[model samples]
Target chain A: MRVDVRALGACNRLAERGAERAADALADLTGTDLAVEVTGASVASGEDLAEAFAGRESIGVSVGLDGGLDGEAVLAFDSQQADALLSLLPGGASMGRSAVTEVGNIALGGFLDGWANYLGQAIDMTPPRYFEADGAAVLPDGALAGDGVFLFESRLDATTTDLDFSIYMLPDSGPFRDLVVGKTATAATPGAEGAAEGTGDAGSTVVPYESLSTFASLAKRGSTNAADNIGMMTGLDTTVEVSRLRFVPLADVPAEVGVEPHAGTVFELQGEPSGYLAILFEEESAAAVAASMLPTEPDDPLGDMAENALCELGNVMTSGFIDGWANVLGTSIAHSPPEFVHDIGSATISPIVAELGRRQDYGFVIDAAIQTEGVQAQCDVYALPDERELAAALSRLSET
Target chain B: MSHPSSAGGRDASGSARRVAVGVGDLAVVDGDAALTTSGLGSCVAVALVDPTTGARGLLHAMLPSADDSQSSRPSARPAKYVDSGVDALIDELGAAGASPNRLEARLVGGAEMLDLTAAVGPRNVERAERALADAGIPIVARDVGDGVGRTVRYRPNGELAVRAADGFERTL
Candidate 1:
């Protein structure tokens, strides 16, 4: 075969959430669930190859019959898609074909397996073909003469990686079973054209992730237990972990955010840029947790169980930031807390919020991940910069 | 990744022009056109355009080539990996009137998303640059293989500027 060489990489990224995201993106794009096939590929260059330079890469691919989906085809992406897949990688403007190769070797394997199983077919695939060019050129020019095509494209908002896949197939599928059948198969059948595409969080993803600020005046009593109160209001399981919640001067935090909590009964800490948390459990855990907390009956949309957990989680966590902050600033300010957002891209949680609150003179931001019994939750809290109070606090923050 | 910000706040002229790339994203600019992208970290970015057509192309890659033992799974999207993704970008540029022999190449990205544990970044950079070179396309300039992430931009004529950034930015 006339293979065009681009870059090469081993499947070292096949671990933890890195592996899961690859699997999920694959399933979301190809309509099939995937499992990891542990294998390794080593590289030749280390000294010159150690850095993020051009003209070098290392990633691998292997094919097998998970015997599930009807048809399976992998479409390796360029860095453009890699840009979309990794939360930290930026847009396509900077990367090369190598990044896409890694995405292809590691992430594409999961997607292919997922789609093959989704189609309920024993999928036999060729060894991967790597090169330097746009992916569309290698479309089954001759092989797809009779097969219809299922072009699935997915994006990872965090990595800016693109998991774009196209399966050349016959319109009708002869089932062989072994797919994700049972319940999820029926639900995930994306009945439409063959353009099977969507991030794992595509469904119900339109839930607006707007960054908002609500103002609340401190109550007369100091021990209002507002953070815990938010837990009650939202009805879910949550915790308030504080490394150092002591009352201190306002100048401790970064100056870019102008808000000096010391002026308002709130202290601050060393938050570099932003931070995050992970949220995941399952439905049973959610029900148990909800049963113990929510005053209302916990019988709603099964999916909402996680949402409930997340809302309270958001409320409680932000309340922690508020409580700790209030002590630092030495003022009692009320809070209009953050709403919980579920099925979110864990990587983009901060970027989305930072994108929104970048210009605002906010006091603090608490990025939280509420793991429910089943569904995942990503919630964040942006301390609305109190303008009048902050004007006074800046002078204090600046004075050594 | 470099180029901490994808869309830089408007310059005094309010004209958005520069070589800033996003992850898994691309920009097509005419010969006289200008484009910019965010930097890349471990991800590898490939840029190839026809000087005659001014058809600019850029692809950020993550792994190496699609044919390597590391990339034997044929069910992957070709554009999703360095091996295949670079192919996808080359195909795109070719369609835009870029002759394979006439295509110029530049690379960025492939940062160490993790610490010093793998060769994904280097592999990506090496594969893409080598492939284009093997095809007789010259890589005029490149900024690849930095432990930190980068943001890169490219002018259709292959004028690129890159910035390095730490921390992270969610995909756009």
Candidate 2:
């Protein structure tokens, strides 16, 4: 729809001022010099909104808006920045969840309070709900379910802590447009009207985020099982940290994975919800893991024995991961034996992504980091669910 | 799967300029300049060069057609879709003093980078091929498919180099 640029600009300024006040509140709370500025404000569809966060992991806090408006307000931080912020608070490094939530509450509360003052209306806000997931998963359900949304975004850059975060407000387009432009409901923008015309199409069906979360939890269980299996095999204390599932643009995959050459094992899941998985390790990490898998320390770690060990490790890991999906979904999930490749990390995964890209614009990526105690080895496990299979799996979840 | 040939590095003589063509964008250049675009997964890069005049143009188009509602809008960017983008590129190349009859095309990218089951890459390739055929531009060589993301560099001298994510580079 044709957004009134002047009205958008005014709203942007108001949001920026509100964020500045929030920055003051944060500075007083943390005793740090912080700056919050309006970075971007626009109107976009759900797909385009997802594209803005393609391949990124974020932690967000969303609060429902009630008085004088109908929408959601979200404040998000990149995973790295969130970690940095977490480490700044007292007992934060060890117990970050509560502290992070507290921070989100204060920051977003102050922002909404200031905005209410600016608009001369009492804006009632619900308690903030903390979400640590990929960008796509964390987007408010209202935005995804609607044809288009009004996005007002701001960035918080903390100088002392060196942490950068973003705050977003997504308002239902109809009311937001009226509020911003002071226009009546009858004067709908032509663009919005056109977008509304295709309301009942198959493509517009909303895939509930709750169903996706079910799959995410299954992925977490799989990672944990894989971690246990690895620990048993290598006799090393291993732990898996599974990140939230994210929808990533196919073109941005290489950069997202750190485009260096890595040794990888590729596996294809064959079943109702079929997909591909790639486990990647940096050269040094591969050598370290391979060395640990060996019965005795090898003179040369890059030998066939090491490669075989890696392959076996891949097989065990894939089984642990996929078996969890099959069990939870009540379906059979078969997987191909791992195929090893030593090349640029992106190149190894590109073909798999290409296979998916042939059909869809975006692919789902679930990243699991495998860490072993006292070993300088780290393995990244990536799970890409086939689009059709993903849909089927989600539908089954909703049905059950 | 052939070993990558040495093909992508720019000339060190400091004479050639490098121009990057972003997604949904096109550019035409002459002389020692090289036009490049990266992160091409499922999107096709149509590079046109006139051998006689040393003029080259690169169009990075994301979708197959401009028949969508968005494109129907007057504010739509022409270079975003294959149908209109290819035509725009040809017009721009002609504006740059290149003869449309003498233009030779090289297609890169349109690789399926995700297992989405739709075959967007092949469709993109097909659309581009159809558009170029309609425009009467002959495609000399192409590295269009097989599920690998590629970065393409097109020189005015008709040297079209494509480098896959594996660091495998080949001149087509």
Candidates in order, interface RMSD in Å = 16.6, 8.8
User: Chain A of candidate 1: what's the TM-score?
Assistant: 0.26
In terms of docking quality, how is candidate 1 classified? incorrect
Q: Once superposed on the true structure, which residue ranges of model 2 sit more than 4 Å away at CA?
A: A1-209, A295-306, A376-380, B1-34, B38-46, B51-55, B59-98, B107-151, B155-172
lDDT tens digits, residues A1-400, model 1? 0000000010111111233456566545434434322211111111211221233332223232233443433443343434444433333425544444544655656545554443455455445555533333333232223221212222222222223332222111123111111222223333311112122222311111110001111111111353455456655434432111111111111111111110001112122212222222233433444454555656663346546554464345445554544554454544343333221121112222222112221133222233333334332222324232433332332233
lDDT of 2 by residue, A1-400 (tens): 2222223434554566668777777777777767652244544456545654668898888888877667888878888777688767767667677777777788878888866765557888888788887867666666555444556667777755678777777776667755754532122333222122222222322343345445545656787788888888777898776644444444335545554657758888899678788888887888888887888887777568778888888988988888888877778898988887665565456556545533333454555666777665667776777654655666666677
Q: What TM-score does each of the candidates earn?
A: 0.33, 0.57
Scored by CA lDDT, what does every candidate get? 0.37, 0.68
Give the best candidate by lDDT.
Answer: 2
